[model samples]
Target: MSSTNERMFTRRDFFKFSGAFGAAAGLAVAVSACAPADTNSSAGQASTGADASALNEDGTITAAISYELGTNGYDPMVTSAALTVAANWHTLEGLTEIDAATGETYAALASSMPTANGTTAEVQLREGAKFHDGTDVTAEDVVFSFQRVLDPANNSLYASFIPFITDVTAKDDRTVEFTLAHEVGVFADRLAVVKIVPKAAVEADPDAFSANPVGTGPYRMTENGANKTIRFERFDDYTGPRPARAAKMEWQIIPDPSTRTNALQSKTVQAIDSVPYLSIDQLKATDTVESVQGFGLLFAMFNNEAGNPFADVRNRQAFLYAIDMGKVIQTGLSDQATPATSFLHEEHPNYKRAANVYSFDQARARELFAETGLTKMRLLCTDHDWVRKCTPLIQESLVAAGIEVEFTEKKSADVYNTIDGVPGAYDVVIAPGDPSVFGTDPDLLMRWWYAADTWTDTRMHWKGTAEYEQLQTILAEGLEATDSATQEQKWGEAFDLISEAVPLYPLFHRKTPTAWDGTTLVDFKPISVTGLTFVGVGSTK
Candidate 1:
């Protein structure tokens, strides 16, 4: 097995980009926003009800996201946050999509499941679908989108998803073919998340395309730039079910939670994406706003490369035992989080919640420290407000357990860049993993922990063992197995082995607290991974 210290990029490194996965493939097309010349029969005029100016006459919804957009050129290939924002503008009907009801995969873009022909997968394009540029969407576009992500030079973050596919060819205008390098399951689910971009539009001007992306989705990017508000207008020509409400959507970048809360209270912004946990109670009490929990993990990741104390299993386990998870969840997290027992979230299907592995036992932690003979270590984390609040709580807990704790907080970019390039920056860092619609797939989990070259697979640096290898094999095979029971059993086995080893001390899963003005915004549903969807949201009175 390759040593975890190897500086190769692996699937685990892809997790950071998973939040914005698939948005990187297509080119942006300049959409003509001006009303068409032919007043009676123009595409825009025909789609917009007789009263075109009053399309969204009710009101507009404004949102605040934590990060700044367009810093990475709005290219999905390099920018994750931009990819997420772009997802609202494009559509890729995949062979399977997450069933909103059961969170299971179901057919969406494809008419039926691909046959088990090791070489080829077939898909039929949905009829009458047209890009925002008024170009008809065909199977050719879908084939091109998938192939683009797999391009080695493009360095698309989600390249691993389709690494097994050798070719994507258009069988006909409405039909496409995929030739696989190997037999793989979950292919459709992976494709479902990929947003298809227009080939002609991207080829026109790749740089300009990022800002003016065009897609067949319900909304279109009307205006966008760095630090400036991103505006999305409803696509009048959208072929899907008409959205419940018509409204213009705006995403304003606001880094400070206090400022965001003030905007919410003052009715300046209709909704805020990540309401700081500290402000949840205050927001909940306000009659003008409603707070909702977001689905994501909040945990500490230990780097176990050479010279790092976390390289020792005993030390890692000791750190876990020293931390008081309950208090951290209550005080640091504002009851919006639950003590995490495993990598998988409780809401996920096939999730086997493990019992507390390292329940706050200062005595055991001290004993482990003595056995390991480790000294004081610095825990590295970002200087973000939440991390700042959480890390100190962890420091206090560890200190009580006879461990001297030091901290080094840097900007978010510096933290990710340093950890990605340099192996041993600090012993442990606070991190979060957002799984794309959970399933019992070890490919992502094992890849995250054991993949030799991944920046995010810090555990692999220290805890690579024969047992870990065996569990990974079991997980890989189970995900490919068609039988649900066998898959569950295999997942259970892997979960048990991982919990026993405690390579990653499950800290807590965060419930993203978001506050939205209910009176102004209508039909708002806070999703699990991404925050607000502008598709069904609209302004009230």
Candidate 2:
């Protein structure tokens, strides 16, 4: 049988899903009736005298964050928390770094990108990169870091993203070579996953190292208190491209959106992350709120293991067919969101419209449900703001399609824990995920949720199936293809197969809204994803 990448998909008669994120659609309204916050208000005024001295002289800035400190520890490989990931941007250094907004790649720890042949790539470390503990970063550290992730025992969340890597070697004190199992088109971008760490530090006391991470980046962890706050002191001796403009930063873990917003309103925090969508207008009337284009998706995942009705393709297709995406966008998500046709969005360079584009067809959904010989399901959903609102609507759609629906709401983490525990427990999962949170490349995006021994093998439970094996083989082939044209075609082929298989698919990409005290912050811009960036930013007030 041909690999999943070689599968031919017949284009079904379907509506072309098309839309940009907010900007062109005139959905950028804040509050028309309420004017913006007074520019001259003390809270709105730029820093002067004592405030200016505190920033410039004392060099400290406190920001309100939605995620808790030491959520998954300071370990780059283990931590999947957004705040930890963002914090790592200051403390850790990968060979290449991806800009969260532009999806552009730039050199971080490595002086330049690795020179690559088909199966091998070589890199040279910067002349004087030093860890926060005053230890020199060497080629040995680079090899150890990559190998640590590659080891199956480590069970690194990002290890699956770099499956092409076969071996990493330290050729010299400053030189390292990466031997790949196959040629990856976006190898440089993939390197962003492996944030270089000192081997000695990690080996000596892994737990302590995770508590107090030491890296060659612009910032060093001064304090990492559990659930309270994380403090980063600028590494004055650091020599790197991106330097900390502020000498010290305090990341306050304020998970409540209202509290975070209030902190910004009272000028208690110079900035805040995860501004509630409903509060955007209110925050904008007083503070600065920026909603950027994002790939953050509400994933509708199915448990594809045996005995689950969702294991059948018809049931999976039926579930999607029932959802009225239009209503979901208007009600659950604002017009700031874009409905997803495939893993690749309309704006993506290599995007090909997915086959079997599920339009709202209750009749078609009923037909698919009849084939399942099942009329009911227990839908498990996240307790996220919009997700909670969207669940009842989803349940209603299922009922309209002649299927009885029952739903249980829980925290996103608890929902995942349940799904990850048993085989036939969950029927469906509606949760948020963003591939761009790791890397922007389509390969990384697909591999993150679809790769073997990853999501499919673990949570979704589609392992040992012909379809799953085919996907694995196809991914390997796609990675091996040297030419861009062939590589893209191969990837596109895999995407088509995935659409047909339908283990899990994205419903839509929602724009992330963030509010900041613009008057107090310099070079502080709201980002589309979770986690606020403070590099090269300081207090202006």
Candidate 3:
């Protein structure tokens, strides 16, 4: 297929770009967050599961997490680390919260769900709520939290999630009024994006507060991610609906899939996330393991800067068509994922099939490559274990299609560190991301990659292009439309536009596997997100 002026990855003088995984890829970085006493942290002093003797104390939970804290701290405003974000869910509260297991939004800090429609709505603070530090939760504190995230100067990554909110003002000591740009039916649900913080604590010492946040949630962070292990204690003063059932909790930051699996098998931790695909059946023998389908995905992102070979939409589309997604899903992922039919997985509530879907067509791929004069390309891939599985096969397909491949793998964090980001930074990048950990809304998911300056400007370099403008307009219409059918229609249009653009897109949606001891932990429902959640979970040991 040829189009008028179809820019191809051909000219000898032309440069190529790299692809990075979208924000919805859920794998954690290989490294853990900076810690003051990491080596000394002991998540378990318990015997192995085979010992037949119990040593863990009652009301205590231990877990091994595949995600590490990396350079980020515990602050909900900016930290994207999978482990830190999940931990925050235990130690923080918003006016409303989306449950980790059910995806249902419920009032947490607010007395009840407020009328989040219209340009204006008021929220009443939950009575007798107290912060981890014993300070009473008040309306002013809620306003402060929202303002800090909305403050452009703060550069909070979450600001993009609620662009409709114009301002937040405390109507009185216990009531706060939200001023929106327009009516938003999901307004209360989106508020969960910004976890309420204590103004006094945050202002007292911002750095200290980020490392160890104080909130009105069920748990208090005790370890601040020092020593590769994070510890939490149940906050007795918390007056929220989901009170912590465990008195103490310890999380071992184990990024290596094998080590994380062993930690659970050896009874070192009660639960673990990111169970390697091959190890799932083995783990099921000794523990309860479930692979939950979610919005997490491994994606290919292109460099859309002028002169970059992938600057042309045709090349981007051709790259997607080159891969055999059926084989990739079956062999590479152990049939653990669904090939992308839309930007979202098939399970997503707002999922709409895109205008264009890339199925493996080697003959067509070759035709596009030959049309564009593209013979050789460099690919940069993140070295996550599972990613290692898929990239090689993706490389194999391109090579079979008569393209020379210069493929390089690096730790996810290191890729961004060394990349100078010239016009074509290694032609393309394949990495993992999962922003659905924030919320599952179509607007929230699309904003994360399309409208966000970080992805569109710095990564894809498509911010000022005509296609970007079109996608943004469609997204705005969807978010502002209160009617369900109209919003879905607009969102479907946005998905179709992005589907054709393919600036950055998911290859497949992942089925995240999590394992926990059914006999030891009570009410421990596995989450489809990157890490583990222990809220309302207890231990019988």
Candidate 4:
């Protein structure tokens, strides 16, 4: 197997499956109707002529997020990244939330579950809560905020998740009613992502609201600037038990991993998302830094609907066999990534052991290629360092297996844009797809890959089998088995059928590493799927 082909698979798997473990990862480019503004003017400048001590009476913590925040508004309904940053918002109230331990969804803002008929759900708003602007958080605001996501113009990424809801209305000052299109089991979990925003504030200036978001969360957005920084002030009116230890927080966008590491080491920044594999050992050796391994999946992707040489199952199988995943895992990832045996990570609750299925066999791969009779092929990839590093390993592996391979490197966005929206751009390309954090619902995964007819921006245009469709139906309606034992059986059957069809090739799971300054920080909890939560951070002193 050629190292080049192996690396190609790595690049694809790294991005596509990063989110499979339960948390959404990636850069979110904020999309608001308003133009960009200087959001850092008040950083060193105090508001109301107050001193830094007055603003942050106890302490302040600064965190460096790898990428700039994206198009999703501060509202959680739009994107998970926004919801992560707005974790403090729950200190105010949300419609619902997930229990961190069991992954079960529960109502937070509402008092109880919706009535059986599904016509309406009863909600009891927390009293006396106020938005940053001083507007009372009334039931009317909650209803309006939810309705905004349903608006087609908003084109919320979460639209499919809330298909059962039709309307939400305030029945009284503290209670609201949700009218449903049908009875849905995951409705509460879906609502967990809906952060309540002030109706008046959003309606008044939707664009400005993106830059200067105002919510009833425990933190308020204070400042933002282009390529500068975003600052937040802790909300003293927060009614939740986990009151923030730090009165002020700043998210400094440092795109370069090295710069972020430098910031942490120099005490200029307190914490950072995953350290690169190359830097892990060095970071671990430093007494000032604490390292946490995160749960994330990495897999290679093939555009079956794109109709290249790889569109043929035999060819894809040949490519899979021709590559050496074990060597790539050990070398390219520096032994940080684990070779995936099944679609889900071994650590996940429902994961099934299927090591034999993914085992590398160059002889078998050669036979598969001889049977397919495919020769020359092109492997499309991103110019990013990681992908670049893996591509050569894959190319070399494929060449060794009597297959000719060519490499093309383009900027990440450009590569995705060219191959995704259009068909037949290349024989194979690398990409990423994240699964929902709640759990690995086989039906949901299948729909995203085959049913939706679109992979992210790429039009998958899947030509699926009847069995796969039936499995999807079972996924949507088969949960009535009364226990997890029955549910697992049904899901296992579905995975078996899907695996036979080869809709996607499972690659090794990637681990995300976070580095922090241990001297200044006391505690940190790395949530499995959801990104790191600020709620876990505290002062050592």
Most accurate candidate by TM-score: 3
Give residue 359's error in model 2 in angstroms: 1.7
Descending-TM-score candidate ranking: 3, 2, 1, 4
lDDT of 4: 0.54
In angstroms, give how far residue 412 of model 3 lies from its true place.
Answer: 1.9
For model 4 the local lDDT of residue 502 reads: 56
Report the C-alpha lDDT of model 2 over 284-362, residue by residue, as the tens digit. 8888777665556677889899888898999999899988888878876666677888776665566788876877888
Judging by lDDT, tell me the better candidate of 1 and 3. 3
TM, every model? 0.78, 0.87, 0.88, 0.77
Model 1: per-residue Cα lDDT over 433-480, one tens digit each: 444332224454444344333433533354355655676577666656
Compared with the true structure, model 3 gives a TM-score of: 0.88
In the order shown, the candidates' Cα RMSDs to the true structure are: 10.7, 12.0, 11.3, 11.2
lDDT by residue for model 3 (1-541), tens: 0122322221111111112211212323211111111112111122123222332434679998775453445677777767667888888999998777666678999999877656999899989998877888888899999999888788777888999999899989899999999888788878888899999888877766766677888888776545567788878888788887778999987768999999988999999988889999999999988767777788998888888888878788889999998888888889988899999877676778999989899889888888888888889998777888899999998898888999998876566544534555668888887777667788888888888776788777889999999998998888889799999999999889999898999999877777888778866666564677776677776
Question: Candidate 4: misplaced stretches above 4 Å?
Answer: 1-57, 71-77, 80-93, 99-108, 111-120, 148-154, 164-167, 179-187, 287-295, 354-356, 382-391, 408-415, 436-457, 463-468, 479-482, 529-531
> How much is the lDDT of residue 148 in candidate 4?
77
Q: How close to the true structure is residue 217 of candidate 1, measured as C-alpha lDDT?
A: 64
lDDT of 2: 0.71
Off by over 4 Å in 3: 1-58, 419-424
